[model samples]
Structure formats: structure tokens, C-alpha cells
Target: MTRIVLLGGGVGGSMVSNQLARQLKPEILRGEVEITVINESDTHVYQPYFLYMAFDQAVPADAKRPERAVLNNQIKLVVGHAERVDREAKDVVMGDGAHIPYDYLVIATGSRPAPETVPGLVEGGHIFYTEEGALKLRDALAEFTGGRVLVTVGVPHKCPVAPVEFTLMVRDWLDTHGFESSEVLYTYPIGRLHSLEPVAAWATEIFDQRRIDSRTFFNVETVDSEKKTVTTLEGDTVSYDLLVAIPPHLGQDIVKRSGLGDAGNWIATDRHSLLMQGTDNIYVLGDATNLPISKAGSTAHFQADVVSSNLVNRIHGGLGSVRYDGKVFCFIEAGNDEATYVKFDYQHPPKPQPPTEMIHLYKLAFNKMYWLSAAGIL
Candidate 1:
């Protein structure tokens, strides 16, 4: 039997497993193939909803579901923390010292925010990347009266446009709540509003029209929570009443412990083949890969299609010819119940459309429909 193991059960992992289970159902039933998914959690979370949850627009129950319900029945679900990947042995070592052997392996372990990496950020800034952080930020916003709202962005973070979305949303929130005296200030690490040239131009135009203040080339060096000030590496200090930050992200610890990742714990992957560098039977996808693309859910969904198709073809004794083109799609909230979207690939640059209410509604609809996507139904 050919044992195919998925090291993570996020959207990419789940979609790939379900796709294989359906396409290779005959082989699976005949006991000629086995598929397994190993995840650290029993529940899967739709992380995009965390932004909405910060404003009480969504609840925890809306973003979470049983992981078992998200995967195909033919796929085995193993819920435990992985200790490391023994590539030479072709097996994954569990925290309890169990070995799960595999003939083929897919690594979809996602990235995580590391707020503790920044000096004083954990105590000074509000991060909405996780459930607890969102709730805490919500409470802080509730008590806020009128003051400067600072939105600082860190590099290599998931959801590149999220900080921009939050800044726009909070600008509207202050207006709606009658906090007219409040100020909204956004800072980026690069010399522009966003990494993408077109996006930065669009966002800069919007910021000017909205009277929102912005600063570029502001690399955070440290934060003084007691003084409510953030110092930058360029020798500047900025003060804020409420600080919202997008913290730097790192891949799972297991990837680093296994020596499969770089200094940041992200695996060096072949951008086209979606395979680990110098490996034939192993694949990496989503935020786990050190690809120079936006770490968005849509990227994972697209990569999952390529990985699953290639794996299926290989199982049938055919050369896996499928290649990923770095496709990524994202919705940008433009406040006032309006949104815009961007779709681009390796060969094309995204041209964002004008913000509209219809696109905003579509984003909300997709949030609820994310489960279906994870099940490989759409």
C-alpha cells in the first residue's frame, strides 16, 4: 500500500486530502492506498473572521468547526502535536514518540504570529491574529473615547492587506461611534503603503482622500508600553492612544526542529513544482513555503489543486506534470460597507477594481462558505 501523509490539516492539507480521497476512491477502497492527515488541533479555524470578530461582527462559533467534519471519511485524522519530521526515515515523529511512516508527504503546516519577538509588543500593542487577541482588542476599542489609533505593520505577515483593512475599518468605526476627534495613523516597513506597487498607489490615494495619516520606512525597534510610544530603527518615536500591530510570522516549530526550514522556519520550496527543494516525494504549500507571494487562504486553495492533481497522476505511474503559477486572490475592505478585490498570478500584476458594496457582500458570503472550499466541493 502507498501511504500518503499530510503533515498539517489546514485548508491546503484538507483540500488536497479530500481531492485525493475522491479521485482515488477505488484504490483506497481496495486497500491499495492510505491517506492520513496529522494536525495539532481537533478544530479548524477560518482565520479571516478574526478581523471581524475584533469589531464584534463575528463570533468564535462562526469561525470554527470540527476538523473531522471537514475531511473525507476515507482520510485518517490524527490529532496530536508533531515532534519533528524524520525525512531520512520517511516518517513523522509525534510528541508521544509514535512514528507515522509515509511513502509520500505533504507539508502544509501554516505560519503563526510571533508578537513576543518584538520588544514590548506583547504588552503594548493589540493584535487580532488569534481569538484571544481579537477579543482583547475588541474590549480595548469599546473603552476608547477619542485618541490617536496607530496601525503598524510587520513584514512577512500573513494576509498582506489585513492591516490596511483594519485601518480603513477603524477610521469608519470612529466616525460611526461619534469619535470625530480620533486620528488614524498607518505605518509600513517599506517606502510605500504596501509592498505591491499598484496596491500602494491605490491605498495612498484612498488615505489622502480619507484624511488618514501614513508613514513609510518606519521599522519598529522597540515599544515603551508605559509611555505609550513606539521607537523605530531610524531614530524616531511615535506615540499613540491605541496601537494595533501585524506581528512578524514564523512557521511551525516542528519544521525548524526537523531542519526542514530556513532561519525563519519557512521551507524553501520550488515555486513552480510546489515541492521542497531537492526532494521528489515531498511537497510544501501555503504559509509553510517561503514563496514571495501573499500568504492568503486563496493561495493555499490554488496550490492544493496542483498538489492533489500531481499526487494523483504520480500514483497512477504517470509523471506529475502539474505546476503552480503562484495564483492568489484577496478581498480588501474599503470601509463604508464597500470592498475591492485583487486577483493575480506570477505572470500578471493585480489591478484592483473600485470599491463597491456588492464585492463586500461577496466577501461576507465567502466567509460562511469557506467550509465547502475546505471539503473540496468548490
Candidate 2:
């Protein structure tokens, strides 16, 4: 049997697992292939719902589901920590010392929030990347009456447009929930809303309208939790009653130790086929790749479609070089019951297209699609 082991059961991993289960026929699946996923968490998260944390739009109950429910039963589900991989030997090693052999490997390990890397962050403030973090932030948002609310962006983040959405959405929420007494501050190392110029320009206007104080090109250096102060590398300090932080993301140490990482320590995959540099049977997908696209769930869904087709082609020993356009079609919730949609790839991350109410509806609709999609019911 051709054993295929996938890692990290997040949005990217769950989507790919579901697609693989669907595309492989019964006959081929029985004798030719075996699929399994490795993950540390038992719950799958609808990360976009994290928007609710600041305004209480959604809760922990809204974003989580049993991880197994999001995957296909036909595939084995291994719940454990993946410590490393033996690419040449075709096996995965767990933290508990158990080794699972594989014919093909897909590294969808996803990303992790590293608050410790930022000085005084862990000791001073909280983050919202995980379930616990979200819950804590929810409480903090609800309890605080009003003060300077700083939502700082750490360098090298996932979903680059997220901070923009956070800025605008929080404005709408505070105004609705009577928390408009407080001001919001957005600080980032970069000078714009998005790296792409067109999108950045649009976001800049939004920030100004919301009355959000922003400092561009200001790299945050430390957080003095007791003083509720955020110190920038340039010696500027901003005080806050509640601080919402977006910390730098890093790959699982497994990739770095395996020597499969790139300059930023992300997995090095062939940009065209999504395969590892030195191995044909191994593949990497989602944010793990050093691909030039926003590390968004929609990006993973599109890449998974391409990777599944390309993997099947290679199984037949056909030299099919299926390339990804780095395509991404995601909804940007701009608040006021309005959202923007962008469909572009690495070649063009920004499409200065017009905005429409249709995008807002689609953003809401995506949540329903996601729950169904994750359950393999769509």
C-alpha cells in the first residue's frame, strides 16, 4: 500500500485530507493508497471567526469542532506531536518515539504564534492565535471600560490583510457595543495596510476614517505589561488598557531540524509542483511553503486542489508539471456589513478591483461553507 502521511490538521491540512479522500476511488484507495493525518490538537478551528474576540461576535463554541469530524473516516487519524521526519527512509517520528512509515509525505504543519520572541510580550500582554488566547482576549475586551487599545502587528505575519480588517471591524464593534469611548492604535513595521500598494492605499483611508492612530515602519521592541506600555525599537512607547498582539509566526521545529527549511525557516518546496527540493515522493503545502502568497485558508484550499491533482498524476508515473497560479479568493471583512474580495496570486497579490456588497455576503456565506467543507459534507 502507498502510505500517505499528512501533518497538522488545521484548515489547510483538513481540506487536503478531505480532497484526497474524495478523489481516490475505492479500488485505488484499498490497494494503492493509505492516508493518515498527524496533529496535536483535537479541535479544528474556524480562524476567521477569531474576528469575534474583540467584539464578542463569536465565541470559543463557535470556532471549534472535533478534529475528527473535519476529516474523512476512510483515512486514519493519528493524534500526536510530529517531531521530525525521515524523508529518505519514508517515516515520521512522533514525540513519544513511535515511528509511522509513509510512502509519501505532505507537510501541512501550518503556523504557530511565537510571542516569546518579542520582549515582555508573554509577561506583559496576551495574544489570540490559539483557542485559549482567544478566550482570554475575549474576557479582556469585555472587562476593560476604555483606554488606548493597541493592536500591534509583528513582522512576517499570516493573512496580511487581517490587521486591516481588525482595525475597521473593531471600530464598528466598539461603536455598536458602546465601547467607542476607547481609541484603537495599530502599529506595524511596514508603512501600509498591505504589502501590495493598491490594497495598502485603500486600508490607509479606512484607518483615517475610523480614527485609529497608526505608526508605520515602527518595529515593536518590547512590552512593559505592568505599565501597559509598548516600546518600539525606535524608542517610542504607546500605553494601552488592552493590548491585542499579532506575533511573528514560525514553522514547527521539525522542519528546521530536518534541513528542509528555507531562509525564513519555512519548508522549501518546488514552486511549481509543491514537492520537496530533494525528494519526489514528498510534498509541502499551505503556509509551510515559501510560496509568495498570503498564508490564508483560501490559499491552502486552492493549493490543495492543485496538489491533489499533481500527486495523483505522479502516482501514475506521468510527468505532469501542474503549476499553481498562487491563486487566492478570500473575503476581506471591511466592517459596516461590507467586505472586499480579492482574487490574485503570487504573480499579482493585489488586484485594484472595485468593492461590492457581494463580497460582504460572501464572507458571511464562507463560514457556512467552511463548517460543511471541513466535515467533508460539501
Best by the TM-score measure? 1
Each candidate's number of clashing pairs is 0, 0
Give the C-alpha miss distance for residue 201 in model 1, angstroms.
0.6
Stretches of model 1 off by over 4 angstroms after superposition: none
Residue 148 C-alpha lDDT in model 1: 99
lDDT of 1 by residue, 258-283 (tens): 99999899999999999899999999
Q: Please provide TM-scores, in order, for all candidate models, with all chains considered together.
A: 0.99, 0.93
lDDT of each: 0.94, 0.78
Q: Model 2, 1-378: lDDT tens per residue?
A: 777788878877787777777777673556788888898888888887876664677777878889988888777898988888887677998999899998878888877778989989987776767777777877876777877778888867777777777777777777877888779887778766567677877777777877877888777799998988989988898888888888888877888877779656788788778887777888888888877677888777777877777766766677748897878776777888888877787676565444567878877777868987765556
Model 2: residues with Cα > 4 Å off, grouped in runs: 262-264, 352-358, 375-378
What is the lDDT for 30 in model 1?
Answer: 100
